[model samples]
Target: MPSILLISDIHGNFPALQAICTQHPPEQFAHICNTGDCTVYAPYPNQTLDWLRTYQAISIRGNTDDKIIRLLKGQTFKKPGKKEKRIMYTSTAESLTSENSAYLLHLKKKQVLKLGSYSLGLFHGSPADHEEFLFDNTPEKRFQEIASTCKYDIIVTGHSHTPYHKIISGIHFINPGSVGRMFDGNPAASYAVLTIDEQARQKIQVQHFRCHYNTEEVVNELSRMKLPEIYGIMFKQGKKLN
Candidate 1:
């Protein structure tokens, strides 16, 4: 079967990242497409980068990832609140390691790949804005606007931190949500394994894979390290804490 591993907003939670791999296993995907933000929030920056490197996923730069890279370049970062400060410190401090800094700095912004019969465009936010968040509540008119500028059988976007799929005018738009920082009430570091094919008669079929991870492990790790932003509570509830 032709398959794609769609992930985003890993945010440094290594256990959830591990759980995703353990559940799907690398053997399952034809390709792993990450929509960025792999280096903040949680406590496993290097580990997260290592896993992505293992697959050498087609990654696009996220807004958060951009900020991390900026810090690595010794550029001044915006003053974050207490929670945001924790994220800044972790990402900045952990990334001082040359490997992490260089890796993040060199990540590509976006790409379009052909998967069998489908054209898949990978981007962190909208094609127009890498950080422009299109949420479930985004107006349909905006969706129409996004559809107008991008051409692909499927458009894969992350940043809203929600897993959703909706087909408009024959274009399939998908957000795999946060692979390591889900706010889906159960906090399993949600992601999607999408299997699409033309229906025998003539149409597309989509299957959404929503999996749950061990929230306690994430919470425990957060508490153990005292990571910033009280992110643990949000993940536990499966929604954005900040």
Candidate 2:
């Protein structure tokens, strides 16, 4: 049996990623995949991207990543929403290095990976829409609709910052949650490990892990960068503000 690590919504919190690596190193997994949002909303954007590149994790473009790409290209929506404005104007976007910018630009919107006898569909959000919210409690009809659109044994997604696993129409759907900014009222960093046994008709096992890191250190880094103080509050509270 080999294990795969699924991570998403890094949001540039390097310490959280560091803690995850410390607990679940690359050697323990067959492959490490990221659902994206590698930057924005916290400090250490460059460091986070560097780590992802170094690990060579299979990744896809996230909504935050899309915003960065648009900013790099000097493009904006006709009527920018508050979230769009916040993401485009974040210090993290300003600090992204050219090398990392190129890295983000090359990311695909979705990835389908073949692992042994199983096929996995990976996306930042849903297969049809990258910004859509698909959570644990999403209606069964909605899952069925998504299922009708894609063919895969398992579908993995993120962007809601919530972790969940469910079987809809005999397909396994899992969200690994947020690696950096978690909104589940838990301050710990979150990720998931998936084990597939090729011998047992590709039996799947999913485990979610939460690693505690030094929140004060991250807060101090954000303060030093002179970013929004609300970000610091969000990190401490482990919930989104507004």
Candidate 3:
């Protein structure tokens, strides 16, 4: 079986990121792909970048990645409320190296791959837009429409910070979810492994997985940065802080 790892939306949670890396033998997987958001939301943006860089991710730019890159390149930002803007700006200061910033800047919006009979398209959001997040809460008809627009047997994406799988229009759409934030009623860091064969051409195995980390580490780091304390609770609760 040809194997690939799908990771996404790692918003600078170092503990979660490191746990996931240790769960696997790097040589076992043929490739690792990410759907961006490699930084933001918590502390350790630079550390997370270093981890991904060490792994040599085949990455697609998520909205957060794009936004950060723009901000780092001296563009203006307006997301995350006024307080968050200040916090994010302060935290990311000196976090992005010139080369890493440029790497995020040049991340592809989409990726297409062909191996024997299998067809794959990878995007951070939807096929039409990198910022479009495909998620479990989305409408079924909308998924049908999105799947139809793409001419591939399998589509991979991330952004909702949740991991899920859908079969539509003879197409398999997969979201490995967020590696950093599961602030959606599940605290475990989530990802997926996809195994498929081109000659068999008809089978795809998607394994949605979650791994726990020392939430306090991330929380403490965030607290140290004066980021929203709720982020700490969110990591502990596995969802948005109540």
Give me candidate 2's TM-score against the actual structure. Answer: 0.94
Q: Which has the higher lDDT value, candidate number 1 or candidate number 2? A: 2
What's the TM-score of every candidate structure?
A: 0.88, 0.94, 0.91
lDDT string for model 2 (18-108, tens) is: 9998999977888889998988877888999998888889999888888788877877644247753474245666788898988988999
Clashing pairs in model 1?
Answer: 183-238, 183-239, 184-238, 185-238, 188-213
lDDT of 1: 0.77
lDDT of each: 0.77, 0.86, 0.79
**Which runs in model 3 stand beyond 4 Å of their true positions?**
199-202
Q: What ranking of all candidate models by lDDT puts the best one first? A: 2, 3, 1
Candidate with top lDDT is 2
Judged by whole-model lDDT over C-alpha atoms, candidate 3 comes out at 0.79
For candidate 1, write residues 38-95 as lDDT tens digits: 8776777888888888887888788778877776766756555565554645454564
Q: Which ten residues in a row have the lowest lDDT in candidate 2?
A: 76-85
